[model samples]
Target: MIIIYYKNRFISISESESSTLNSINIEFNKIHDINIEIYKFLANNNIKNLHLFGKNPEKILKKLKKSFNYVKAAGGVVVNENNEILFIKRRGKWDLPKGKKDKGESIQITAIREVSEECGIDPEFILLKNYIDSTWHIYDESTEFILKRTYWYTMKYVGNEELVPQADEDITQAKWFNLHKLEKPLNKTFLNIQYIIELFISQCK
Candidate 1:
């Protein structure tokens, strides 16, 4: 039997079961199964704040030594030519365009691609600047385990083209919000997002 562990759960693939699971190899490939089992184990044991790592004792200890309580992720504060910032109303909240990086893509490319995909604006006329800030948050509901790391960047729009939001992706609308109108609505937005906008405003002054 080949035993694999991740996110605090043990997964065993016996030789007898190998023939039936021909297409699957690594335990990571069975992430959904792993997550389900992890959740079940957690519920059964009434465990919270579980620390997960590889089964190798040394690796596990090393990971725990370097682990953070929260995860890191990335986002963007995009301002257009009118001096207004591009914002998206998503899931009844005002959100900026951003997401996780894809394989073989640079951080800058991730920012530009995410902005274009979420806002339907081409990157050709957008001026992307250095990373503004990074925020850390805990995301537990979506998965049984694993934290995310995100980064945020500031981008300036250079075109006069009309903006269109990607409606199919839960982004209902995208438009520029003036500075005066930006605060109140943004305060009601995601906390990290609000902070990023405030930082951008402060930097401009």
Candidate 2:
């Protein structure tokens, strides 16, 4: 299953039909033909999620993603030796350190560099560079619409360093949160962040 966000509405693509029948349950292949109807449903209705079941969900999703402007980004979920998680308060939400990929830069390095730059921590401080998963989101920025694809990774931090949030980036706070007390911070994050965390844990096994 894949969920793509379009503003406040979400389009969920899956290999099998979901149990709950909705008005917008259609094959992903038919999306292009009835895109206007889908948009109208999203705009006029107050629905939370829309489902599309198909055999080739990934192929359909890839095609649908091209309908808008797309950009790639990378970030990491850094964990300390004590099992605490690194988190940053960015734009008032609890978020991981991540940024857009630099030209000619590898995606792996982009994840390390973004975390280091955003938290004022050294790249070497994070031990593991293993990838986790990628998440997709679409949002409107000012007058323009954007589709952001973020690649997530699982990193380990052993060094003792002070957390610093990049002020110029609207990051107000950076701290290591204890795993047991993650509920508060998790509540302050985007839905994708939670999905990323869950995916990272599953992939680590």
Candidate 3:
């Protein structure tokens, strides 16, 4: 199954059905442009969710990729010895520190570099532990549709460092929240970030 988010809503593609009745379910067809179809679906305020299923979901995913400009990004879920999670506030919304991958830069390096640059932590102290997962989202930019795939990593901060949110990036705050007290902050973050955090927590359990 693959899920691509657009703002707070999402469209899921899978080989089997896994959605509620409120969702718009459709079988995949090669005749229609799937990416444009998704854009149209996102434009409708009434469509809360969508599910597309077929015998070959991989083929559907492949076709979906062709219609948009692709962008690669990387991020981290950083934890400290105190069991606190690092978070940043960007444009009034809570977010994980992430940025676009530079040309020829390895994805792992991009993750560490972004975390270090955004949160004022030294790259040497931010140790990437494991590849968590990736999230996809689509948006419009410069008269084109952009499909951004952000690779996420689980990282440990070995140093007790003060956070300095990258002000030029419109990051207002960089703070650590205890795992037990994350309800409010999670509520203010993007859906993709929320999903990543939940998936990470589930794996730990």
Candidate 4:
């Protein structure tokens, strides 16, 4: 199954009938293409989510992107010596530090650079580790719909420097959380954000 998020709403692609009673369930097949009507149906109704059945979601997702622009991004689940995780509160929502890729940048460095920039941590203090996972989400940019594909990495924080949240970037605060305490902050976070963090933690365990 593939789940693509749009703000708090989601488009779930699976073979089973969706559990979302309020969802707009559409029957799809490999031979037929998803069209603007289905996309607009989700947008117009302020529906919480969509469930597509009887189709290969992997291929359908590729077709969905053709209707909008896509953005590439990278971020890190920064951890410290105590195994506490670094987190930022952006626009009152709990979030990890991340940003878009610059021209000619490697995905690995993009994760490191975004973490440092958004959290105001010195590059020398953070150690990059193996990649964690990737997540997909959709949002409507002013003129167009945007589908963001973010690469996530596991990073270790070895610095003594104080954490600084990038105010200019809309980050209001930055702090570390014990793995067990993650549930509190996560309650107010985006689904995709929670998904990435949990996915990383599961592997760490």
Each model's lDDT comes to 0.62, 0.80, 0.89, 0.84
As for candidate 4, its clashing pairs are none
lDDT of 4 at 162: 87
**Per-residue lDDT of model 3, residues 1-205, tens digit only:** 7989887888788988775757888788644767667777867867877888899988887787887798999999999999999999988899999999999999999999999999998999999998889999987778887889999999999997789999999999999999889997898988999999999998788
TM-score of each: 0.62, 0.86, 0.93, 0.88
What value of lDDT does candidate 3 attain over all alpha carbons? 0.89
Candidate 4, 19-93: lDDT as tens digits: 776787776663354766447754665777777777566766777777668789999999898979999998789
Q: Over the full model, what C-alpha lDDT does candidate 1 score relative to the true structure? A: 0.62
Please give the lDDT score for candidate 4.
0.84
lDDT of 3 at 92: 87
Give the range of the ten consecutive residues with the poorest summed lDDT in model 1. 15-24
Q: What does the lDDT read for residue 117 in candidate 1?
A: 86
**Runs in model 2 lying further than 4 Å from the true structure:** 6-9, 20-23, 32-38, 41-45, 202-205
RMSD of each: 12.7, 2.5, 1.6, 2.3
Runs of candidate 3 with Cα error greater than 4 angstroms are none
lDDT of 1 by residue, 1-205 (tens): 3332332333334323233322233333334444454445445533322333233534433333243243333568888767788888877888888877887778788888888888888889778886887653333445434445567888888888777888887998888888667775676576557667888888878
User: Could you give the candidate ranking by lDDT, starting with the highest?
Assistant: 3, 4, 2, 1
* lDDT of each residue in 1-205, candidate 2, tens digit only: 7887654467788888766544357776666654564456456557667777889888877766665677899999999989888899977789888989989999888898999988999888877567788888877668755778998888999789887889999999989988667887888788888888777767766
Model 1 has a clash total of 9
- Considering lDDT, which of the candidate structures 1 and 3 is the better prediction for this target? 3
